[model samples]
Target: MTKLTKRDFIAGATATGAAICMPAIARAQAIVLRWADGQAMNHPSPQSAVKAGLEIKEKTGGRIDIQTFPAGQLGSSRDMVESVASGALTMVTEGAALLGQFVPQISIIEAPYIWRDPAHMTRALKSPLMDELNKVLGEKRGMRVIGVTYYGIRHLTSGSRAINSVEDMKGFKLRVPEVDTFRAMAEAWGAKPTPLNFSELYLALSQGAVDGQENPLPTIQSAKLAEVQKYLVLTGHIITPRLVIVNDAAWSKLTEADRAIVRSAIETASAWQDAEIVSQENSLADTLGKAGMTVLKPDLESFRKPVLATLPAKFESKWGKGLWDRIQGL
Candidate 1:
């Protein structure tokens, strides 16, 4: 090899410096991501999402800035998923129920009376079952699951009447998110299920378009459903886990380091959201009672067995055989 001259040495040093500065320059001109949520602005779902965005901005050194749109300012819940799937938006929040449409396996987690406690649910989610779901979503739907937040135990509230038993559910029209598991559960327990968007639920309830709707305790409080619906029946049908999703196309554009930062930020925020949910949900029943909504902790036994006896068999194909048993084992 020939000996290097001063000019060559100076040129090599300049190139090295430029390469070192490139990532920082790119960070300064970072991509702006839109993170959408259909829940109300003050709802913990959107609040947690905003925190995630802030964390990403900090952790990524301003390389990825996420902007949040809550309370369906962008559109309906389904609309947000479609937007992210098509890469029109960067992020979205979907409960396991909604995610079922995109990745059918996700719905199994929404099955009623499956988990004994929050710890059980969390363990199942961290197991291979969840790994399979991530694989299915990534491979089939081009969606990435960056975070999982606790959505709390969903209970039924009716504008029609107080339902203490499964027999009370007959001849009722229940508003369900457009998820098959919910529809199936409602039907099995003796109600006509009407699928509706989250943003439209309050109006539907108030207008008599649907007799009732089911949601987590925080959702009831945050959406102020107590204002219209009179009865809260703690059926505890679904303990939902909300997911923070990113468009795979947009995710692929990021550097590995940035992707890791995004994941960590979202996960940290997810934990915070879960804690917030536990805190908020603890007092929600009393709060609803004070809000003039009749809160009933009914004998869920009369309701649970009917659905368990039928819904699982019908839903098994969509959720994969043995999935329910696997979840229980977890």
Candidate 2:
């Protein structure tokens, strides 16, 4: 055989060293946590999640690794929940409105006028009531809620025209998430609620599949919904909260040390995301105006009255009056 060149020898040595070092590196490294969200990678929620992951690795001295998949690369919010529940996926960031499907008691957050401001909502979340609810979710649903981040204040956007009152929404085809609370709200507003997958919403709007939809300003801006829609009604009917969750199975598998690192990282991310959402909401009116969309500040109380009148009785009977009272106290 020909003599081995110096380059070949060096390459062979490097390969051998890498092979020997890999197991040690892994042993010292943090367990890799996989997370997926429905928003685009650059969106604030996912961006915050990514930053939090980096912080976790740094804080833990590379003892844990976090990998985030954005833009529904895995699937929609519902699919994410199922995957996480089955331990097929590690974690997901989802909206409370969507999570209502699995745990109906959590839907109380989506009630119209439930919170006067973001601070009120934050306080309510930390209450014993919510802590008990978390236990129910963990014990019954097999998921752990790490933390919650605000999405934004919900608003109505339409292709037809401005919605100034309850009457304006009559007979309108409004797109809603596949959740009962949202559908109920749409029906109470006199609009025909059409459940559509979020991925299909843009095309549906552009093709006239639906006349209107509702979401916060950042989502409207990030998704470029203003480009396809004409009128925006600022009703602020709901203050949306995004829940960060992990599969109970996956969470249980982690060492207690690793769990502590994950929790701390998530708390940091929650604070960052909430502040960012507030700033974005404050600036969104100007942003939407520049995008050439007409923004209407509708009579929010008038819109809320109808939904509030009926929802309490309906939900209290199903869940419990005590739960409703606890939420009201908050």
Candidate 3:
């Protein structure tokens, strides 16, 4: 080896110093986004966000880093969305019902019996119609919805009596979210709708404060509702979808290529989450049955007729006339 001169030695030292500092510079320049959600860490949606965050970092070559906060770590779902809109938070996964307060038409996604099934729901949400709604949401609230994931279909659970028909719902005190659609759904079935905080539901059910409640099977399992509720009636009343929303300003800051990478990562994660939710929903009935709940597949048509007849008329004005039919056509 040739002996190095002072100039050569200085040059070598400068290159070594630059290489050592490169990673620290990249870390400092990386765009870190906080993605928050209300679901527990074990829940599919939150897990999906975690998966997307990893993929985003990998695909963006560490230029973008997503940090996920699950189970209301940041705040309640509504609060998180508000934070996103105000730019306090970078992103949030929220239900259409909560986002509906921004665009009333969007809330119809949670209307009872509107979607024929999950496939239909997925198609409608991905369709051009939703693009129009998304535009409206962005314009009205400065929030942009980038991805949608399947949250399980909502069903009824009873502590005392199995809901076999609409008649069976008469005088039934059903716990429902304070949302008007849910309250209207319970009333259409002839049940007395009790608006209560979801945090209080388990104790309420255990003590007979409410006769029945409705939620997706995965939620039922995750919340350990099988312990408090004795009967699972497959009314399949509502199909809920979670929206991956970001502040428009935050989304606009990314380069187009980075935006594409982030979107692709989220799409991949959502597909994985959808499959997991469907798998869990398919098995949950038996799982809950084994846990001492009687699982009943009630005549869904009986449940469907009343909801369609009453709900569409009640909601179509706000959701846009024919929006219900358009979604059903999906």
Query: What TM-score does candidate 3 get on C-alpha atoms?
Result: 0.86
- Candidate lDDT (C-alpha), each: 0.83, 0.81, 0.84
Model 3 pairs in collision? none
Model 2 shows how many backbone clashes? 3
lDDT of 1 by residue, 28-51 (tens): 566777787888877888888788
Number of the top lDDT candidate: 3
Give all TM-scores, in the order shown.
0.89, 0.89, 0.86
Off by over 4 Å in 1: 1-28
- State how far residue 49 of model 3 sits from its true place (Å): 0.6
Backbone clash numbers for all candidates listed = 0, 3, 0
Query: If ranked by lDDT, best first, what sequence of candidates would result?
Result: 3, 1, 2
CA RMSD (A), model 2:
8.3
**What is the alpha-carbon lDDT of model 3 when measured against the actual structure?**
0.84
